[model samples]
Target: MIDRDALQGHLQQLLEADRFKDYGPNGLQVEGKREIHKVVTGVTASLALIDAAIAAGADAIVVHHGLFWRGQDGRVTGWMKQRLAQLIRHDINLFAYHLPLDAHATLGNNAQWGQQLGLVADARFGDQDLGFIGPVPDGLDLPRLSELVKRKLGRAPVVVPGDGRPLKRAAWCSGGAQGYFEGAIAAGVDVFLTGEISEPQAHYARETGVAFLACGHHASERYGVQAVGRHLEVNLGLQHAFLDIDNPA
Candidate 1:
């Protein structure tokens, strides 16, 4: 078992949480038991996940997305109250790492996603270097790449076809990062993949000849937290469980 503050400090240093300006605070967001033995990790800390952690006899809950965010109503009412009450009542610690989890070189959502899809990341781009760029296998076109993504992620991607060009290089940023499409295009990649797509990206793809693929947001980011959980289990001698609550978006 590890002290809650120690665990949080280790993670903060490991992920370099201070490097980026993120949407919300990184590291421990809620205080619970001081000694954390068994941890439950997930993509998001929804109420369902909190209940599952409680049922699993977890001492701590670590996630990519935590309950609190910037600009949210300060009042903890409704769902927020329900989640916080459960954690507090159970004495389960709550920890969240947002951009840091996404940007970690070896244990990040983008890195894990790229590795799972068999893509070798050679460069990083976009804000805080969250985007990755690399080459696909030879003879792989947009259609073939889309099929590969579906096979690996277990969800078919929404595709915006390019000018029928042979795909040479690809770039990606997981989880609602269609905003990085233009940046990927600027990086000279033939295709850009992200968790979600907006209407304008289709037009941009059509005009720029760079294909666009919208892999499911949840599906794309299912690996990093699992990776971290395994890291803790193997290296820190802590019991860890990654519970994935199904999310189609």
Candidate 2:
């Protein structure tokens, strides 16, 4: 068992959560048991995930997406109230690490995802250093790279092929970061991969001759939380389990 404060402090230091200005608060979002023995990690703190964690007898939940975004309504009501009620009633702590989780040098969303797809991440540039620029392994063209992405991520990414050329340098930012494609293009990457695509990204890819791939946001982000959970089990000696809820988007 570990003290909640101790766990939070360790996580804050491990993730360097204070370095980035994220939309939602990092670390403990709600107070729960003072001591924790088991943790459940997931991509988001949705009602289903919360219910699953409570059912699994978790003392705390570690998630990539937490509540209380900067622009969201401040009042607790509706779905927010229901979610909070479950946590408070069960006395389960909610720990969320957003941009910090994504930007970590290792065990981060971008790093993990890039590694899984065989991309060697050499640099981080773009907003808050959340974007990763790297080189796709040689001999992997656009078609082959798309194939690898779909097979590894278990979702067919929407590919906007550019120039029909072999992809070399690539940049990726997991989860709803299509806006950073311009930055990737400026970085001279042959392709940009992110979760969630906007209408304008298609045009940007075509105009700039940079390929675009929209892998599922949830699919892309599912790794960092799990990696952190595994690290917790090893580093903190806490029991950890990753709860994956399917999200088609």
TM-score of each: 0.98, 0.98
Per-residue alpha-carbon lDDT of candidate 1 for residues 145-217, written as tens digits (9 for 90 to 100): 8899999999999999989888889999999999999999999999999999998999999999999999999
- Model 2 residue runs over 4 Å out of place are none
lDDT tens digits, residue span 1-249, model 2: 999999999999999998888888999999999999999999999999999999999999999999878888689899999999999999999999999999988899988888889876888889888999888888998888888989999989999997776687999999999999998989999999999999999999999899999998999999999899999999889999999999999
The total of clashing pairs for model 2 equals 0
Each prediction's RMSD to truth: 0.9, 0.8
Note the Cα lDDT for every prediction shown.
Answer: 0.92, 0.92
**Cα misplacement distance, residue 220 of candidate 1 (Å):** 0.8
Model 2 reaches what TM-score against the true structure?
0.98
**What global local distance difference test value does model 2 have?**
0.92
